[model samples]
Target: MTFLHSFEPGGVERVALRLHEAWRAQGRDARLVMGRTAGAMKREWPDLNKGGLGYEILGSERIPSSGWETLWMIIHLPRAIRRIRPDVLFCAGNSYTIVAVMMRVLLGKACPPVVAKISNDLTRSDLPAPARPFYRLWLRIQGRMLDRLVGMAPPMRAEIGTLMGADNARIAVIDDPSLAEADIQRLAAARAEARAAPQAPGRRFIAIGRLAAQKNFGLLIDAFARMAGEHDRLAIIGEGAARRALEAQIERLGLADKVRLPGHVSPLDAELAAADALVLSSEYEGVPAVVAEALAAGLPVVATRCSVSMEDMLGGGRFGLLVPVGDAAALAGAMSDIAKLKFDETAARDQSRRFTVEIASHRYLALMEDLARA
Candidate 1:
């Protein structure tokens, strides 16, 4: 069973779902277990409710994305696990793993081996000084308790080794599974269902992610404001609490006409296909699914070097440029330069082989089975 919060079926949730589907396709019993069902992601993605793959809701009525969700999971999970009886409990993130480790400590032999997936820079170095100490201590405890740690990128493994005190050899590296050719075709078909928003005739730029502090979309807006007049138009896709703040920034930048907030369009992959390039202005990530999806769609990218995988994803800065996080000037310069640079779409798509579901599924199962045996 793959356990996740499932509030927003964003990249992490989507990757977990893909792995669940892949495991089922291989004639194995795999299930997606979620804590909550009522969220904006369910309405948007709706893949879970479609009911092709095996899934179960743990009777968690309250949202698990925020608040004391970890405590709730620790209280409720043992009963759910006993009922489900999965061979191994697969956690989609550190939070889930924390619950798993704590349960193992409390319940002892009653709990199953946990394989937790890591997908970000968990070192908390990017965090505020006050919070970093607490997070570090928390990670130190959780890291020691995890049975097996799976990293989506190289950075995650290193962070786990340093922070969690896990041996380098024990940390498994599996690329995030996203955007196979068939999914893109479906996204293309979805695109044909509706007309895209009108845009100025120019090099159209696309940046996707929630309007949150982590995505640092405000930096992108600032960068675009500086460079957008040179026949560049930016469309930021996604909806979040920061919508009002972003709208204010757009107005302040005088980019109301130049930038479009299309707000969470379906077939986001197809939307990426239409743009000239993808800009990832995130403060941090571990091989973001958008970066992989963008490459699969033959779209180049200009992203912050937030994760260890950014350099490899950018083809060693050949396909695109990687800049410092939250640096608007550096991002603006890279965006301008990448727009002028040209590369073949076939070549761009070729660079995304490791992120393909087929390859990643085998890697994940191999690690899961190995850990389950131990």
Candidate 2:
């Protein structure tokens, strides 16, 4: 079983749902537990509620804030696990580690082993100086609480091992499971066809992520305003609490004509196929699914140095452009220069093979079964 706070349209929640689907397809008995059955995912993945893979909801009321949602899960998760009786518990992301620790305490030896995924960056440079030490201490606590820690990429494993103060053997490296093998193949074919066709002079850049502070989309807009050509266009895809602020920023900067906010686009491969490059201006991230998907589609990228894994992801600036976080001037320079650079489509697609869903499912099951037996 896996525990998620809600079906929010975040990468962690989406990856969890995709993994559940993959597990069920392989005849594994996978169940999901959510604190509330709310969010854009309900609309994005409507079939999720139609009963292919079974799920249990712990709360009926709508949660007003993320704090309340976490509280709701803390109050109710142990009871749900007790009733369901899953042999191994999958703690989906960082947000639920506290609840996992609580389960270990409240349920004692009755609680099943937890395999937690380190869903975000362990080195949170965005936090205030005083708060950073406390966060590091929490990471140490997580090392003690979790039965196993799964990092999405190989480079991430090193970060987890160093910061969590966990032994190398206790850490597992799995792919992000962002794309299926078939999906990658189809996108690669599309990229080839797009390459062969006559391309327009003007470039269309795409960005995918929630409209939130973490995404730093306002910075993206600011950067775009500085260097965007009259013919150049940018489309930011996804919705969140920061929508109003982003819209206001776009209008104030007179980028209303050059930039657009197309909220929550699904089947993003098609959009990637149509675009010249992908941009990510996040404050921090684990392994962003969009970057993986873009690479699978052979789309070049301009991203912030938000995570330790960025170097590996961008292949030391060979596969994509890497910029300093929160530096609008540097980002603008990179954006203006992206179309001039030539990326190796074959190499990009080959790098994407590490993140396929089939491999991730197999690795996840093998690790979980081993833990269950131990």
lDDT of each: 0.76, 0.87
How many collisions per candidate? Answer: 0, 0
Best by lDDT: 2
- lDDT at residue 130 of model 1 (Cα atoms): 93
lDDT for each residue of candidate 1 in 1-374, tens digit (9 for 90 to 100):
77776556467777777788778879888877677665565654456546555677766575444466567667777778788777788877654667778778877887787788876767545798999889888877766777788887665667678887888767888877876657655544443442355654677789887778889999999998877765678999888889999999999878888888978766676577568789999988877888877776667799998887788777777678889988999999988888666666567667776677888888888887887787
| Model 2 TM-score relative to the real fold | 0.94
- Residue pairs clashing in model 2 are none
Candidate 1 ranges with C-alpha deviation above 4 Å: 40-51, 60-68, 184-200
TM-score of every candidate relative to the true structure:
0.89, 0.94
Residue-by-residue lDDT tens digits, candidate 2, 103-162: 988899999999999888889899999999999999999998899999987789889989
Candidate 1, 218: how far from true, in Å?
Answer: 0.6
Candidate 2 stretches greater than 4 Å from native: 49-51, 61-67, 189-201
